[model samples]
Target chain A: MKKVTAHDVARLAEVSQSAVSRAFTPGASVAPDTRERIEKAARKLGYRPNAIARSLITRRSRIIGLVMSYLENQFYPVVIERLCQALQRDGYHVLLFISQTEDADEVLTDILQYQVDGIVMASTTLSSALASDCQNAGIPVVLFNRVAQLGAMGAYSTSSVTSQNREGGRMVGELLLRTGHRRIAWLAGAEKTSTSRDREAGLCDALAAAGLALHARGVGNYDFAEARRAVHLLFRDPASRPDALFAANDHMAIAALETLRTELGLRVPHDVSVVGFDNVPQAAWPSFDLTTVQQNIDEMVDATRNLLFDQLGGQVMARSIDVPCVLMERGTVARRDDEPGRKPGRARQPA
Target chain B: MKKVTAHDVARLAEVSQSAVSRAFTPGASVAPDTRERIEKAARKLGYRPNAIARSLITRRSRIIGLVMSYLENQFYPVVIERLCQALQRDGYHVLLFISQTEDADEVLTDILQYQVDGIVMASTTLSSALASDCQNAGIPVVLFNRVAQLGAMGAYSTSSVTSQNREGGRMVGELLLRTGHRRIAWLAGAEKTSTSRDREAGLCDALAAAGLALHARGVGNYDFAEARRAVHLLFRDPASRPDALFAANDHMAIAALETLRTELGLRVPHDVSVVGFDNVPQAAWPSFDLTTVQQNIDEMVDATRNLLFDQLGGQVMARSIDVPCVLMERGTVARRDDEPGRKPGRARQPA
Candidate 1:
């Protein structure tokens, strides 16, 4: 079968080939009636304007390179789905690159080969060298849920979107302190990550303001197994067992809850109050009923999308967006008299 | 700065442009010392071969359209990550399309415009018309973890890779029956899915061979909320409350377990035994300890990769490959004397 081209559609629709092309090109100027006629003819003839040919002419693939890691984390999959949907609405498709921290440079090289219009780096850090490469290539990159830690050089040249991690941590700290928790411990995610560091800093600040210090701490590497080990070690010394524990993320928090209850035989909010960040779907399970800081994913996604577009439109000077987090009070945290009347736990809602 | 080209690299390395291209291309012949020179020069110049231009020359985008839904299902995220990694190793990039069931056609149309070398439809159904369109377009498509249920015409023209869902379900039925659970209920995933249908059929076949029938059944639509509701309705009447519940997938099974234990105040395996398919990470969590069928994801992924390549290499005549499932004996199911001495549950292991 001979491939149907824009010429065939134009002839059938009684329009110019350029008219058919404009009709197919998103955001292109075309009369409404002409677009309708061209679309009808193209559909009838099974004509799909070759995106590759158009991309060569315009130097715009309308494809975004999404470099992501930690798919095991429930939160990331949600972020990925939302980003794809949001980007698709703007006529952009995602060229997904699953890369590890050490391999970011290699993956970035591969993405550069494809000449994706923009890049979204989620939950992973990029080296300053690669960031400079992206800048040189004129590919707008927005870090999602992670902040670049490149030393002052060209740092502000890359945009980022993240939840206010330190504030969320402070909220958890204050809640724990108000609930009469004298000894509080923290289970940090990967120590190198800015998200983990900022949240810990906020927790420390809150603790300092209350004239107390963190009783203990452990690094979970933002994983379940590591968190489980942290829980075991944290509770081994019953004399210094933390009255309240906060995990850097929900995955670790859920794992901690299970270990505390099943293995350690501790009652949540009674023997040990627990809180987590990123109110992932599993956090709301009735069995867990975890109190967590919600990261406002939709807002963060929107900010990232807008940042990429702005950068693509030649807006220089890197921007960092901080979306607010909400503390979801659930069964995991104990209630205090000084505290305001807590809303009913949102456990019953599906994630 | 001017963009570096193959000609520049050749000039710097003192080699032919074809030799420079061969050095960059995977599985291409290149003299060892000359290839090293070309790579060093390319690195020095910060040059990347333009894949878009090469794609035009080769008429192969080297991009596979991965149309998927349900990233929320933990299984899919793992699948997506593994597939991306596997495809990357084979010199292909993923153009991810997140689509809803109703919009498969629109997504397919967009995919066709990009002219991806092949398509991998994961856990989502496509209309026969779209399958025919793909075949007509000469784009080889492999349905991953799903079977095309296109009516008689052109049904056998598409390839599929799936776990033996019916066999997996039959294993569950036999295990439950052996453990003396007479009053069993089945919680199904989305009704239109071939996986759910095949599993249900196998369960029925096993029950029929035992001179029994399904005691009760409910549709969970392969979602948490829907499964929670199914659990409530199935247990509403204490007299007919099912002693054994088999969920089509791990997500629904986990939801059912939470509802049964927390809301219904039921003891798993004592009051009710639970069995689920797709032994997902959560199934092994200390709290759930769900006995389920384990789909060999690695095997399935490998088969899918091979199938797509074979199809692309002009191997016509559609084929369907079924990888086997293993029944993981965990804590959720009651033990039977006829069964071998099972090892202690591997719950402490990380998901």
Candidate 2:
């Protein structure tokens, strides 16, 4: 069977071929009645306007490259689904690229070939050289959950959307301290990541304000298994076991909860109070009931979408947006002074 | 700066423009020395071959449309990441369309406009008319984790890759029976899904062979909150409570585990044993340690990749491949007679 074309649809609809093309092109000027007639004819003839051919003429693919290295962390899957839905409403599709390497250099090279109109980089990092390469190629890029130094030219000219990581970290630290926890331990994701580093810095800021230091620290590299192992070592010394533990993200925090409950035979908020960032859905599950900082994913995704479209609309600017974070006071954190069989006002505060 | 083109690369490499195109095209023929020269020229000129233009000439977009409705299940995110990486290795990119509607018709229509080389539908269903539309358009589609009937012409001529869901369900039933649990309950996913229905059918098959039937059943629609509610209703009547419960998928099963432990205060494997399908990474976490069926994702992904590429390579055929499932024995399932204060041989079997 021969393939249907716009010409056939135009002939069937008693309109010009260019009219049929304009009817199919998004944002093109076409009369409402004409477009309706053309669409009816095209539907009858099973004709689909070729996006590739139109892309060559219009210099727009209406495709966004969504680059990520992994999805083991549950947070990204939610963001991905929402981002695709949001972009779809604006007449664009997401071309997904999962980076095989730690950094996004290799995947970006492959994505550059696709001629995507824009890009959203998640769970990956871009080098200054490649960021400039994307800039030179006229592709707008929005970093999700990551930030880079502003180069002389606005740091490769890529925009970023992130939760206020350092502030969220400080919130967790203050919550832990306000409950009369003297010994607090920290669990970190990848040390190099801005999210991990900023959150840790905020926690340190809170601890410094109270004239206390972290009692212990361990790095999990943002992996479940690594978090479990780190939890083991951090709590191995019962004599010096921290009263409270704060993990960099909900994924690692969940892992710590599981390890503490099952492996160490410890009761949460009793033996140790724990906190995490990114209040993932799992944090609210009754079993975890974790106290965490909410990253406001909707706002983050919205900011990312706006940043990308603004650049695509010919604006030459680079900006960093920090969405505010709210701390979810759940059941995981407990008041140390209110221990069972003890008076409520006698817990020692850090000196 | 002027946009670098294939003409520039051809001129710099002292070769024909077609040779420069062939060097960039996967599987296109070009002399070894010519490709090297073209690569060197491309590198020097900072020229990346235009995939869109090449796609028009080759009649292949090298983009596979990956359609999914939701990523909450966790299983699908893993599949999406793996499939993207696998296709990337073969020079194919994934165009992701997250369906806002329950079915795939709308997203499928949008995908057709892109003229993608193929498609992979996950976590969504397709109607017969739309399936045939894809078949008629010569775009091969593979349904992941779902199966459909063989229509008069092989069920719209789309391929499917799935686990042995029915057999896996039967295995769960047999294990429960062997351990002396007569009162078995079932918590289902969406009743309309083949994965859910077939699994339940298989469980009934095992029960029928043993001259028994399910003690009770509940539908969670494969959602976390719904599963928690289903667990509440299923366990409301203490005197008639089931001894074993099987959930159609791990997401719901994890929710059930959390509800039973926290909300119901029921001990897993001690008061009531539990089993789940799909053995997602969360199933192995120490807090869960769920006994479930393992759907070998690697094998399923490999099969899907092969089936899709086969059709792309001009093989006209409809095929359904079922990767086998394995029972992952863990801490969730318990032998009835082995309960505390109960003699090992005292528990009665169905007979």
Candidate 3:
């Protein structure tokens, strides 16, 4: 088959090659009648102006570099899919670069060579140095669901969407106080991440307010296997075991339940109350039925898409979006009739 | 920050701009000593040869357009991620186009202006007309995880490593005969897809060899919700339900288990033996403990990456591949005490 060229379309349309090119180019002026003719002829011949050639002169490839990690979890996939859709809607393409390594600087160097106009770091695994380096390269980057220690770029997080972690912690602590459960434990995610740190701070603040304290704490690395191990170690000696347990993420919470069910032979909410953050899909799977603090994923994605577009349109004001979170009570938490709040197990009853 | 140019690197290295470009270009002519000096200078300044400008003269862009769908499936993410890593390793960047609608021709037309060297259809959604149009524009495309009815271009499938439907059906029939199962039923994936068709054919052949037949068959649309609904219909009358249930994928199997457990109060492998395909991550989770057929994903990925690279190296061998599958036994299936042919899965368990 012969290659179809812009010249062929131009000849067929009875116009210069430049007119054929202009018909494809945005904001490039040409007579409407001639432009229509050129388009029709190009369609007939299947001729398209080479964007790579044009990119040489314009220096804009219209590719956005997306750096992400933690795909084994459900959260990142939702964000990546929505971001791809929103970017594609605006006549741009996404160049995905997934990494599991700690050093973001090495990743940054590779992205810079691609000459992407901007970047969106949707993974908490991203290094602060890489974020700063991208800004240093004059590329606008917006961090999603994370915070930066060094003030180099824009960031958007949903700290407000859920009950203030500290306040929620206090409520739980006070409830424990009322229930006469003296000892309690906290099973948290890794300490390296800001999300883990913030939640821990909130839990401690609430405990202090109630004149109580977390009897034990363990790290789960935000995975089921790790959380299971953490729980096993925390409850190895019956004397030190807490009457209640709280995990920073749902995977850990689910693991804690498995440990409680298999190892200690404890009935959930009857012998020991439990709570978890980031109520994921499996939380409602009947088997787990965990009570958790729900982070509205759909709303978070909507906000992120808007933030990316705002940056593109030069909305450079220092803005932070606070998303609200809700406490979802299920079979995992103990019932208290006297407590002035929504009851547990409300969502779990079979309709 | 001022952009680092090849000229800057050349001046620092005490060489011409052409010499600096040669240092970066493989097999390009430059004195050995001069090339070393230029490379060192480029690394220090972080200068890259202007690939954007280079594309204008070469009439080839180191970009490939990828039209993809099935983002919600775990299978697609793993495939897309691998494809991205493979392309990046080859020094080529992907211009990703998300094709969700039937009007995939618009996506092709939109990408034509980008002058991509080739294309890959990782989507099950794009129509034949759209695919042919892309070919007409002089871009060679290879369908990944999809087959072309017209055979206009290259394609690779699991035909090489796995048994065809006829062979697979015979195996199942033989197993059922040996195990003394009287009645069997199958729930399949989307009827339009070749994967489903092939598997279904194999199972039927096995049934014929045993002088038995499929008691029932239904379509589940390769979804968990739909599979549950289909299972509900299949087992509405408990007395007449088939003793053995074979779900084509693990997602469907999990859904079936949930439906049977909660809705019908049926016990796994006791009242009804359930089998599934694709040993996904969740298959190992304690709640399901699914006994499933496994396709070696890593080996498939390795083969795919090599095939794509060979194509990039201009060795377009329009070949097909088929990876073999293994039947894994766990809590989902009844113990086959009589069978001596089954491979020991106790050794294959992931550590």
User: Which candidate leads in DockQ?
Assistant: 2
Please, what are the lDDT tens digits per residue for candidate 1 over residues B217-247?
Answer: 9999999999999999999998777778999
User: Could you give the candidate ranking by lDDT, starting with the highest?
Assistant: 2, 1, 3
Which residue pairs overlap in candidate 1's backbone?
Answer: none
Model 2 has fnat of: 0.78
- Each candidate's DockQ: 0.60, 0.72, 0.41
Error of 2 at B115 (Å): 0.8
Worst 10 residues of 3 chain A by lDDT: A154-163
The local lDDT score (0 to 100) that residue A167 gets in candidate 2 is 94
Best candidate according to TM-score: 2
**Cα lDDT of model 3 by residue, B132-157, tens digit:** 56545545666665455443453322
Using TM-score as the measure, name the better of candidate 1 and candidate 2.
Answer: 2
For residue B146, model 3's alpha carbon misses the true position, in angstroms, by 3.6
Tens digits of per-residue lDDT, candidate 3, A1-351, equal 356778999999999988888888789999999999998998887676766666666777777877766565555666677777777888777777766553355566667776777776664434555554554455666656555444345352221122244544555555555555555688878666555666677776666655656778889988888998998888888765676788877778888887788667888877678788777766776667888777666676666656655665553642445466677778887744443443333222222
Per-residue lDDT of A149-264 in model 1, one digit per residue for the tens?
86566454568999999999999999887877667899999998889999999998888887778888988889999999999999999877787899999999999999999999
